[model samples]
Target: MRRTSLLAATGALLLSAAPAAAAQPQVRIHDIQGTTRVSPLVGKHVADVPGVVTGVRASGASRGFWFQDPNPDNDPRTSEGLFVYTGDKDPAVAVGDAVTVSGVVSEYYPLSSGETPETTANQSVTELTGASWQVTGKGSVPAEEIGPDTVPQAYAAPDGNIEKTQLDPARYALDYFESREGMVLRVDDARVVGPTDTHRSLWVTTKPEQNRNPRGGTTYTGYADANSGRLKVESLAGGDFPAADVGDRLRGGTEGPLDYSSYGGYVLEANALGQHVPGGLKPETTRKQADGELSVATYNVENLAPSNDPAKFQRLAEGVVRGLAAPDIVAVEEVQDNSGPEDDGVVDASQTLTKLTDAIAAAGGPHYQWRQINPQNDADGGQPGGNIRVAFLFNPNRVSFMDKPGGDATTPVRPVADGGHAALSTSPGRIAPTDDAWKDSRKPLVGQFEFRGAPVFVVADHFASKGGDQPMHGRFQPPTRSSEEQRTAQSRLVRGFVDDLRRVDGGARAVVLGDLNDFGFSPALAPLTDGGALTDLATTLPPAERYSYVYEGNSQQLDHTLVTPGVRADYDIVHLNAEFHDQTSDHDPQVTRIQP
Candidate 1:
């Protein structure tokens, strides 16, 4: 908690016992780690700064060692530890080795591939570069416990940019983590929020009760409640990272130096790995629709292709047959063409749809027929040349698809009055296919279907993905979701189309469903459900069960299904893929049983 203001001068130090050097105050780790995020002593050289080695990252582009001063300052705003960056060169230091280091202080930012340090909303890691250290003696690196009380309720400054803000460990969690950068810390019996990843890492939250879902993981409901108690863990070199699923417990605990990384803002490079305790979490299956209930479901199959592993196709089919209970109409998104990711001109997905239906039949589900308007080759924003599109799979014996002609990739179908009722000009048509709102994105696939001799309009949509948006946890607080702009426009366009249907016939039975690629509460989503033209059925679920996708340890809803106000429907978000580590797709399919 100690704080010190260094000499106002900003230049190279003599690094010698000269009269000029004598005038400068003695340097400490806290002095370099100033009250603010940017180091006050940056660009200045210091010699004989004393500390003990707490950890060493021997590999990677950021090869370095962390050291902490045994004598700490009382100012909680300043940290007592620092990272000595020996980029590409080995420090050859071990834990518990008391050391005096000499180097130039600087700020380091881990940039993504192709990102330059010139301009960004990213934060910097204060470190000592061009450094040399000598082992003075043996000492212990202190480890602080991060219990429930350690994290503050506030996530960060309201403005989101906490870069120049002074450290307030007692208030904002981001400031608290930034204050302890490069310091040893410990967490006990941490609960897994984000599941284990292929990178040998997982996210665990210290405060287990903060946003608990019935399934044992934290939920991300909005921008304000970010679940700040979350922290990342990784085992030391040559050790296996613990494997755990959502709601699983990190038995015992993990201890190590808290380092910053590009993968996540902060990381605990674990010297002692935590044991994984399973939480008995399993995929959930929904009850099938009763007779006369025309069930419609939406599932983002995660870029499925005919060339993918047969197992994946089979699992997806199993999910549709059993997990979703074989809904009468399934709106499938991300159905890649036969070539998958190959950058060829193949845009036909008949092979892909055929493989899926065959698998569904093999899994003992209904023999389903598919309908879709294929997008232009490589025009849709997905895997190159895959030309992914939203499609429909219907049990022809139960519900029949109307056969109106003239549907194509670039053709926009208009809403027409069919015998005093609302109907699509074509059985399968693309909505505003050439509009800029859907540029390089999947167009909404609108189709007309019949059940019990009554016609119904269905709009299957896969809005733009949130790819180019800034990271929510990045230095830019409440980071800008620029990608949402497109989706918002997409929502408004689809909403207008839905309203057109409602105007055509006051009692038009319409179901709008697919991977909207947005949260139910998002600004983009609000328009779709605005004016009561359509009801976001996903919102009817218990708050804890609303999520359909999991990203960065935050269980959130990115897919949705909506229906006209006059339609009576029962909705269920079948929790099958997201909660489980083993999955057929990243998105959970939602089904709505609508009455005829």
Candidate 2:
């Protein structure tokens, strides 16, 4: 934590020493102690220690250069701002570069990370900052030191040794019998065992529960006998078997006969598990013709990117205004705002949505107003060039906005433990962990509105997470500790919110909508469903049309519209067109007509 001021005059040494240089100072060190540094380090000794290059910004009017190095760890010892130096140099620096310098370390006072470092604060530079000391040619190492030249071999299973197994009703427990924690095996013929709990259960006669070793990377599948509920077959591997209904099958690996009582049950990882099959629904189209009836819809719009420019932020307010039949309210998720310097002057997403509201007005639709919760700049994930978010559009004619809301509607939304890691692991079109800025960017938008003369509470949410083939950290079925904690907290918060709403009007009519970021069958939605506070209308639609987004060419619904039991009979939840998967929107607009 070197705290001092970096004087601009400090860089004068390298600038002056350059012309009459003897061997040309090859190394430069611009100490970023308390202020900004601005200088070039082509052939100077440049030094910086344990810092992340936030970015490379060009200096003003002079084609000069400087790099931003922010302290990655929240350490008080490290300074924040740009380190600058000067010399006739080509440093070849890039964003996210980490380096160490051994030149004079100076401090600059009265500066901030907000403005350019050198211009606002004291700056210093070492004459020999970035000099290259040594050069090595290719193949310089001894052949023996380079290691063996043999091609790595893979273990090939003996022919006909890979066996497939199926389960029958009488052998329902067999699925738990064959799987072992660390050995990767395949399962066939598996079906979703139960919706018994919020964590959807997948039952496979040939698959057992696998749990990760809390201390190491090993995994195991555990078998428990039905007769005594005692553990058996701690680990099993080598084969392709399916765990499904009596006849269905799929292949998967096994790693555990986990201690069910100690760490809950063993988690099962399906070898070739398909997405959860949507539940059956009674098909009936019901239209509302009441004079003041309002049709509201909420859609997740999974990774909706402007055509040809997946990362570019396109304003959808116009499409939302013009594409569908006029609805009183529409809640959307994954709205983006590309306003940063990184976006290269593309349309700001917030501006785009603003235009969408204007489009609604222009289309002779109701005068629609909108609200959104923008995550902190650091919170970004999901798709490239897109900032995932949740927003609400309200028609002034149908509902009047409350001047001040009760809850903090702008906080970053948290994910439930079960859904967190899985959701964050499978965000499309972007790298994981690195692109986790928007992982919790979404927040539930709660507003008070008049629903047909009666005041109703409308809460729109976009839950934390994304889709993933494997659990967080490749932990077996269920999920790992980290992912589970996040999702559990998320669920508790949502449940608390819903409970508060019920207490507001003695459990009056309420509607919850948006991309919950979980399937209809996920336990995350249990609070609303089990409490009978909300009705899941998405489950009432056919499977083919139920999915709002597709992954690996398979369709699965993540968008939803739910209403309270009090008003469930008064409205018909309709799953509109979803067949046009990639055309208008990734999610099909769900239209719900509620009686006034």
Candidate 3:
């Protein structure tokens, strides 16, 4: 998706000159392209360029067509193809038509206009603006094939300097996109990684044997190492493209004109797409309740608010009741303020909870009671006005919440002895709320509960998101994750709290569970696992079934349930979401059975 920015400046490259009767000089497409990403002859008028039409798009902010030279020069960095932008006017150019075009060269940046605007410099698409076209002949245009087999591994260099990336299509994805920009690309038998975006952009990987996770899906191991095989296919030429899910395959091949967009990075503007082959991953069956076992699940409901459709609340209730087997307690994250996304100084979410709990009862589930500490106004980071925070939903009939006072947004909860038993000073308080590590992120919610006369302490956390982290396929070779440091400190704080409980009572049962926002294999998680105070339950599962989230065709874990010693736990990562097209969240709900 495109980041929010003002439109970029579009210079008048084409001058209104009188029609010339004499034949204009013919220039090769590569000469106008010059060897740099920014065209050398930008703002200069050129004429009588001959090429065969490879693809055409007659709609949207980018209304144009693509053509490729029949013959090319010696410079591999110079592209053989070019785009002719008609600017809301129809050029009447069809695919397979050999035509001569006369126009001024220009560089189009999606968002570089206005007084204070943002532009993707050195990444703008070069094109022929305000162009006039004449058909010379009609014939078939062969497209440049791009797949795992066609692209050379040697050319897969590193991404950075535009000069070095001229022909390094095999080593880096950005280089590959630049080298083939504005040309027709054909991908045969590619696998879909990410689902279609709002602009109908589909991400796919040419290498079916790409480095996969233990769950038979892709994983983000490193920067270039993880995303060298993926590509984004955008269909802005109009008409609906079929929606796809992770692990789905595109059979019969997909072809499109390669172009650049500010939001989607480099994309193939598809006029046609192949048939969608399903991944055969179905919804999971509900978990069965056992006699001596108490089920606790953590679900990130994805910013649920009172303003959302009542039907949305109903669907979530069904998932909680059916998919999670009506767990005795659910650590819910992303519960928004009652006013939803509207930032009106409203902080309480009692109305939001009322609607959700009402739906659970109507769906034949236990009447669940929720507890949470509302962050001051916009203290917790998430949707600006939404005031998203972590909460807990427990069945009052099954478990009793030990109610105590002294809990608020800024107050830090500490472990204290209650009737000779280890307990929290505040029943449902925040853990290290004022810590610098949690500057603007969601704070951990701690609670004390008694299930069947056994005391259990729980901490529900929603850590800092990976928004500012460098992408897996960025200019840097091994991209740096700026968000990891904050998450590491937060993890250590939570681990320290768990260790505190153990110090009070050697046989204390504590659970730390929520959307951790860090991978199970990442070094960022070492602080929580290194000391052995707690163990991530995902480590106990077979590698093939350890994931709780599916992203870019990779089965990974961003949510986890870590427990202390003497707490025998059995967890099931429900696959009702992530792998399916219809999902309330990108993460699958996970249920853990704890015998305290």
Candidate 4:
């Protein structure tokens, strides 16, 4: 590729008429888009970059015009397009106008509120700044197509190094973005995976088939693979655009310059969007299981604090009654303290549970009795002062709690043989409370109950979250899941408790439910499901419908339920939340009915 190093000097003329004046060196647009994320000639001044203006963002605080070379070099590692940042200058250059500009090459990163002025993990976008351009000639913009055939595979190369020279441009999203950083490209017949963000950024995919998940976008289940086909389309035309829901298709696709932003990775700032194709997804109806069978459910009530919007409590109650059919017991996660988001020493969620139970009753459901142990102040890892802990809401008429002196927050509950039946030493107790595996994470809440004269044991758990994991588009090829180690240990601990119950009685009706935080297919769950001691009901569902949570664009299962043999259980994931735009919780409640 051609490379030119320009000195940071005053504006120099490309062609000097004076015999004594030296001619300024010219650099190809591809040269400015170096082999890496940062330009090779960054901080240096370059003159006479000839290309056609593809698109322009004249207004806004971060405004720039997109330009591309009509004829590109055969080097696939370098992009032929570049963005010229015109600070408050109403550039007279129009689309299709060939322009020769002079500018200092530099990388620009938009600072987040309270963010420092240095490049950390979050801020990483390269751009050209302090530019001045002049229209040279007029020509039609290039219409190069980048479809499924050209995009990279969802998973990065097996090699661990992201900085390794990009051998193939259409193999990984990171490599593809590096190869075509500023190039003007088109995604024909793309499918919208997620609705537009507040900044009008829409996530879409040109390949809707190959590595596609049942729910529009791709998944990170097995190999932590990302959907390389998925791309973000940012429209800076300065007006409200109708948002597209998941499964919607964009015929003719989007055509624009691919750029990077701090919030989202490489995005195609679309100048034109094609025809809209509706996905035709309808809301699911309430479920109906056989009567007389005690039904239980698991729901992560997304930081349901008392100070939250009153409508949130109402919506959750409606979802529990109408959507989930008001299960006999609900293993609720993220139940903040009575003070809600307030950071006082208060750890009781009685007021929060009472408000929720009262709402359920108002919604024509039976009055629900709740049980939980208030966590130590700031001990449980959730919103600070929120003291989020797992709790159970049970209908006394259907099933009654087998109370045997509940354990405190720091007390660990041990399994004991009770009249040849498996029984917890302490009801509504914490399992392995002081275990290092649960070091700042939520502890498993164990409760024993009697359903129709038969004793059943249930455990409510909220394992370590996947927040500490690396992004799919990080420097590591297959991003390491550092959070899985702690979760695996936590799973083993729960399984040990479950095995104890089964040891007391092989025919034990043990039910494990709540927001496990790990996927059913992830290796972190092998400890619980490997030997078949516990069967995950979600895995038995049709693969496409196995998810209970929607993140980014993939509908995945973060909440799960496992039951012992002889306990015939059927599950129904109430899709009232997650998929819908107006959601009270990020997770859909999973209802399981146990027929004794």
Best candidate, TM-score: 1
Q: Model 4, 383-501: lDDT tens per residue?
A: 77899999999999888998878698999998888887778888989998988999888999999988888888889999999876755655455667889999999999999999887
For 1-596, candidate 3 gives per-residue lDDT tens digits of: 11111221112222334455666556878888766677778898887788888888776566678988878777666788899987666656778899877788987765533312132232567899867766789855566777676544332344443433345554545666676777778888777776664556667777666665433356554333554566778764466676777677788768877887655456777766777887765577556768778888999999999988888898898888888889999999999999999999999999999899889989989999999999998888899999999999999988899988999999999998777779888989999999998888999999999988988888999999987654443333345687999999999899888888878887888889999998887777778888688889988876557777765445577999998877898888887777656677777888899864
Off by over 4 Å in 2: 1-289, 301-324, 338-349, 361-364, 384-386, 405-439, 467-485, 542-545, 569-578
Model 1 lDDT at residue 237: 53
Score residue 289 of candidate 2 by CA lDDT: 33
Best by lDDT: 1
- Cα displacement (angstroms), candidate 4, residue 23, comes to 4.5
Kindly list the per-residue Cα lDDT of model 1 for residues 1-596, writing each as its tens digit.
00111331122243333455336578999999999888998999987799999888888766778999999999998888899988777668888899988889999877886676655556788999878667889999668889998989788876666777877889988889989988889999888888777788888888888778898878888787888888888876546666678888877868888887777678888888667889888888888898889899999999899888999989999999998999999999999988898988888899999999999999999999999987888888987888999999999988999978999998888788978988888779988899999998999998899988888788999999887777665677778889889999998889888888878888888888888888877887888887778898867877767798878778898888888887999898888888766777888898999975
Off by over 4 Å in 1: 1-23
| RMSD of each predicted structure | 4.4, 21.3, 5.3, 4.2
Whole-structure CA lDDT of model 4: 0.77
For candidate 2, lDDT tens digit of each residue in 302-354? 55433324222232333444444556778777766644324443434566466
Q: Which stretches of candidate 3 lie over 4 Å from their true place?
A: 1-27, 32-46, 73-78, 86-92, 102-123, 130-134, 151-166, 212-217, 221-224, 262-264, 542-546, 550-555
Q: How accurate is candidate 3 locally (lDDT)?
A: 0.77
Report lDDT (Cα) of residue 96, candidate 2.
36
Worst 10 residues of 2 by lDDT: 139-148
**Which model is ahead, 2 or 3, in terms of lDDT?**
3
State, as a TM-score between 0 and 1, how close model 1 is to the true structure: 0.94
TM-score of each: 0.94, 0.44, 0.86, 0.88
